[model samples]
Target: MMILALLGVLALAVGGCVCVVWAERGGPRWVRVVATITLAAGKVVQYSAKNRRRGLGGSNSADD
Candidate 1:
């Protein structure tokens, strides 16, 4: 069901966060790999959000 899919995504996000922390402390090669992937995913999300915001008029003020 949809709830199960959402739970799985949340689990992966948490695991990736753990890997990022472990990698920063010089963990094993696999942890480092996962951390790199996690970072890339974060960058992609940030870039997508920025683009979406720009498309929406690039304004953060409410008194527009």
Candidate 2:
């Protein structure tokens, strides 16, 4: 479950990176800002899960 959660985050990151680069070419300022925030939030959530898996929480291993 943890891995799945992190996978979703990573998938978003990959797709978002592509979109952001494309947006940089011609999209609006808000697109950049929104994408940046979305990417950052995904990363933060992923890291939080990772930390939880490191035994900081009662959660299962990220490998699970």
- Stretches off by above 4 angstroms in model 1 are 58-64
lDDT of 2: 0.77
Q: Give the TM-score of candidate 2.
A: 0.49
Distance from true position, residue 39, model 2, in Å? 0.5
Shift of residue 13 alpha carbon in model 2, Å: 12
lDDT values for all models: 0.95, 0.77
Q: What is the lDDT of residue 49 in candidate 1?
A: 94
- Off by more than 4 A, model 2: 1-25, 56-64
Q: Which tens-of-lDDT digit does each residue in 28-48 have in candidate 2?
A: 887788678777877898998
Best by TM-score: 1
- Candidate 2 at residue 17, lDDT? 78
- Candidate 1 lDDT (Cα, 0 to 1): 0.95
Q: Write down the TM-score of every candidate.
A: 0.87, 0.49
